[model samples]
Every structure is written in C-alpha cells, then in structure tokens.
Target chain A: MSNFSVAFRTTGSVTILALNGELDAHTAPELESAIQHCKNEGAYNIIVSGAQLDYISSAGLGVFMAFIEEFRTLGGDIKIAALQPKVFNVFDLLGFPLIFSIAETEEAAVEMFSKGTTHN
Target chain B: MTATIHTLAIPSATRYLKDVRRFILRHARKAQLPDDAIEALQLAVDEACTNIIEHAYGGSTKHKVDIAIIVDPTRVMVRIRDRGQPFDQQSYIAPNVVALTRQGQAGGLGVHIIRKLMDQVEYLSEGRTNEIRLTKYRTH
Candidate 1:
C-alpha cells in the first residue's frame, strides 16, 4: 500500500495539513509539495495535524527539517499537533521537539499560533 | 505461522522501493500487527532499503538491487543485499542530533532509529554483496 493520504484546508493566514496513513520516504515529498503551496499562497503558518498519522521515516523527518528554514524566511513557521506516540518519537529522536512547536491538540496548536510565536 | 521468503531484483531508484513497501505491508496485515507496529516495520524497512539504494548503489546506474524479506509469525526479518562499494557500519556512529546540522549525512540517525525500532539489527560485509538484516518481534 502507498504510505499516506494528504488533505489541505486553509483558514486565513494559517494552512492546516491533515495527514492520514503513513509518512515515509515515498510520501514525504507529497507533504513537502503541499507546504510549498502554502508558501506560494503566502500562508505564514503551517500546522500539520497528525492525529490520524500512523508512521514517519527519516525521509519524512528530512522534509520537515528541509522546509522549516524556508518557511521561517517567509515570516512563518510550521507547527505539529496530535502526533501519535510512534510518529512523535521519530520527531523527538531527530530533536524536532525543540525545533517545532508541537501541541497535544489542534485547538492547542491554533491557540499557540494565536498567542504568537515565542519558541524562537 | 509459516515462513515466506521472497527475493526481488530491480533497478536502483527511490521509486522502486515502493515495491518493497507494498510487499511488506501485504504480509504485515496478514500477520495482524497493530497499526503502529506495521508503521514501525515500514520505517525500519525503508531505512534499510534506502541505505541500499543510496550507499550500495551510490548512483542511479546500478542495474539491479537485491532484497529479501522474511516474515515469520513471531518476528519479521528483512535482509537487503547489494553489490555496491564497501563500507563499515560498526565504524559509523551518529553524531549527536542536538548539536548537528542536516549537512554531512547528519550521521547515524538511520542506524540509531533502526536500533530503536527493531529488536535486532546486523550488517554482513563479505564478497561483493553488503547485507543488512533487521528483525522486529510481533507482540499482541
């Protein structure tokens, strides 16, 4: 089976990507493309909700690491929320917990963005 | 409860690893692992297969890549063999992720992640083939 199914929805300046299924080497690019579109649309903040996400790979992590700087350059940052333990562990292993603003719920993520970016 | 061994030879490309992914997922579901377990299996397998596609081939010109996945009821063993240049896994260790940039391979995360996810992992370097074996146990 292919790794992941991606859905995108935009609200004002925030773009939320809801990832379903697996996020591994093969499907990481699809998410990257979606993020690039967010940048193209001038969306400053990108929130990826992984509440339904099943897994992630190093390639998946690479996509997030590779795009963060570009998003920051565009005056925005990426936040992750509701990541499953198995998936979240991969991000933590890469030390992404320190780099990305992660929240326990999507509401918390939106609240975080509403509160402004202070994790810098 | 039976062992199924399948060997595949295909061109070396990131695209081709999809076949490996599909192969594993089919049996993974048949093995009835929790969704998280299956995903972990996929990650470990990708890390190993990608190492073959990148380090073993080092170039897209590699005509064929060899892969063997063994699925047993108690455990899943993936052995990927390639004829690419030789390297030492033991001599390689990942730099601390906290203080490292994504440049210069960002070393050992692959191997370290494998170790964390899988129950056992080993590399066999001999003759013209480099074999990386990763095994994960199945727990209800």
Candidate 2:
C-alpha cells in the first residue's frame, strides 16, 4: 500500500485537506485528485493541512504548482498550513513562499481565505 | 579514516522511491546524522533517483539505479549509478525559480533541490553508464 493518504473536509468557505505520511512522486497523483475534487465542489479557497506530513519531494511540491494557477484564476486559492519543518524546508528551498501563502496553523489559513487575502 | 561501503539497487521507477528513501534513511540513522542532515540527504537522493528514472531512462522502468553509501565519522557519501542514457551535464540549465513559479511550471525542481541539499554533487558518464555522487557532512 502507498504510504500517503489525503483526507478532505470543509470549514466555512475553505476546503481543508489533511495529508498524512510521505508526499513524493509516487503519491503526488493522490493529492492532485483531491485538489481536483475540491475544485469540482466549487471550492477555490483550499487549505492543505500538513501536520502529519512526514516528508515532501519536488514531485509532491509540483502538484501544488500545477493547480494553483487554475484555482486563483477561478477566484479560489490554495493555502498550506502546519507543515513539519522538514516538509516546509522543501517549499522554502524552492521559493514557494513567494508564490503561496503558508500559515502556521490551519485556522490561520482558513482565516486568510475568509479575508480574501490568499496571496502573500 | 576508511569507512565501510554499503550498496543498494532498485528499479528505475517512481514506485521504488519509498524503498530507496528507507534504505538511505537507515544508513543515515546508523551514521548518527542530525535530523536536518538526514532529511537533506534523503531529499537529495530522491531527486537524483527521480531524475535518473525520468530523464535518463525516459520514464522507462527497465533500467536500474544502483546506490552506494559510504558512512564515515564526519560525513556520508552516496554514489548512484544507472544504465540509462548519458546525461549531458554541461547543457543543463538551472531553472529560474521566480520565472517558473510565475509561469506555473509543474516540474524542474528536482535538479535544483538536489544541488541545494547535497554538499557536493558530481555527474560523470563512462561508456553506457551514468553515475552521480552526492555527499553531505554531518553537523553533529
């Protein structure tokens, strides 16, 4: 079985995805599908909670890059929160912070979406 | 001081990335590397293997990636060998991170991550074999 799984829930206008286990090339597609599912549900404000994410590679990071444009163009946004330091390092190393809003807590991310301050 | 060399071989496929990571982490833990160093080494190895599987083999699964780890008291060295097409290191261009993010590029971060994480990265091609060596120094 794959070591990664994504669970989804809705809090106010934000759709929260709780990711568990490692996120790498093999399991990136699962994340893509979850994001797509959120889009189908008319959720543009998406929050990915990475509290349980043990690791992330370029492939997993690529999944967010692939969909962020579409979400933003549609007046939605994807915010990442609660990333473990190890997982957050990958995003920081790649300069993702410039393009995405990463919060220290899921509630902060939801609040960002609620305030319509998705970027920065 | 001389260190023992340990080797692992896995198919050049994305599915085997988890196994490759596990093997590297085990060696890193045995070497008593710090948590940050272990994570960096793991990411470097994953990016290197992913490049081999995708670019070297053209996403084909027939090739195999052979990884050798040498753990010394102060540093860990990893050598990865593959039987795929030769990689022209000279022609490789570093991605423009700001531009790529603005353009929403989905890929191209693997090579960049590998270079940033590994203390030393060397690529060489001999005959039909391509080899990459990555090294990380132990912080504690």
Candidate 3:
C-alpha cells in the first residue's frame, strides 16, 4: 500500500531498525540501505524487527544473503527477530531458518545480543 | 482463456514483489501448475529481478526495470525489461557453490541457482532495452 519506513536507534551495542510495511523487490533496497547505514556507523550487532513486516520475497531475502558475508567479514552481527509464520516459511524454504539467528521475540533477541549467545 | 498483464516500474526495493509472485501463481494454479513447478518459477523470477536490481543500474535509484508475466493454460512466462546497461548472460560463468560454501563465502550463486531451478532461460537485446525470458511448463 505504501513505501516501507525504517528507523535506526541504538540499543546498547546493537542497532535496531524499526522496519514496517511490505518487503518485496521494490522495498528491499531500503532495508539494504538501512543495514549499510548501520555498518557505516560501525554497529557490530543488528536486529531487524519483523513484527510489522507483512511479507518477504526471494529478492527481499537476497538483501540479507548478499550482506551477511560482508557483515561477518567486518566482524559485525546480524540476526532476525519475530518472523511471521508466512515470512518464516519463505526463509525456511531458502534454508535460512537454520542459518540465521532468529528469536521468538524481540526481547529474547536483544537479550541474545547482550549475552553474546551463539548465533547459528 | 484467462490472461492478465501487470506492468510495474521496478523500484530499487524488493519487498513489494510478493504480489508479483502471487499474481503469477494465481494463473499458474488455474492452469494446473504443480507445487514444485510453482516454487521453481518463483525462484527463477527472483533471480532475474535480483540481477536487474543489482547490476542493470548498478544500484542507482534513477534506473528503472519493467516486468511482465504472461500466463495461459499451457505455460507461464515472466519477462523482465530494463533500459540499463546490457548484461551478457552467455559469458557469465556461474560461481561454484561447493567452493563458495566450503570457503564459507555467502554469495554469488544467483545464475547458477536459477539455472538449476528453471526449465529455460533466454536473454534478448532490442535497441537499448534488455529483456529476459523465464518459462516453466504447466503440469496437469
């Protein structure tokens, strides 16, 4: 219906982007730019709030696919949180459900960041 | 005998494409497309658009991409049109995934993945325009 809106704020050592709206081929660049911004800001940990994310396409997934290696190469961290079932299914199909550090809730995810838990 | 035409100026963002896949799937189902075939078609479309968004304009916001999905009883076809610089698909060598994965590198397998997932891939250049064709046959 409308373009995606993303806001970046610091939560301790993590950078959180309050992502809202659909994430498809058209809006994925915004998410990519947001992540890039975090990287440029030297954020080591990142959290993507997926509660408001209505849907995601393979192209949307590509944004993360293209960046994870670069982020890890720079010794940064990126993890997903609160994935919708339908959204999770897409990621699961792409073999990301096991690859990404996904949390059942944002609080738990943030806690994971604080404890530096294993991000598989 | 049902046909639908969807034309969208491909934005640099990717989240809006769920509807595009849904649009194609709708027709595919009516045409009796099998579940696995539909998944492959979805992946094929994604690979094509990812290439366009990343390379066609070199990620510049000023560039535009056009997509058309045509569906009928016999097959489903997706066409991606872009006015950006041309890409030579034939000379493009697909990255070796085994090596990349073994080395723990995260990317560069789009073309290879798409080739494995699709029945056919064709690229055409007309004037300054580039059009890619991805097709999968219907399964009754």
Model number with the top TM-score: 2
Pairs clashing in candidate 1? Answer: none
Q: For each candidate, report what fraction of the true interface contacts it reproduces.
A: 0.24, 0.72, 0.20
In model 2, the Cα lDDT at residue A71 comes to: 88
Model 1 bad stretches (over 4 Å): A1-6, B1-4, B28-37, B59-62, B71-75, B101-108, B137-140
Q: For candidate 2 chain B, which ten residues in a row score worst on lDDT?
A: B96-105
TM-score of chain A of 1: 0.92
| Selected candidate, larger lDDT, 1 vs 3 | 1
For lDDT, the strongest prediction is 2
Ranking by TM-score: 2, 1, 3
lDDT of 1 by residue, A1-120 (tens): 555888888765678999998776567789878887887878879899998897677877777776776677667878998999888878886677887789998888888878786356
Lowest-sum lDDT 10-residue window in model 1 chain A: A65-74
TM-score against native, each model: 0.79, 0.96, 0.63
Cα-based lDDT for every prediction: 0.75, 0.89, 0.71
**On a 0 to 1 DockQ scale, where is model 1?**
0.32
Task: List RMSD in Å for every model shown.
Answer: 3.5, 1.4, 5.1
Stretches > 4 Å off in candidate 3:
A7-15, A24-26, A36-43, A57-76, A89-99, B1-43, B53-67, B81-86, B95-113, B116-119, B124-130
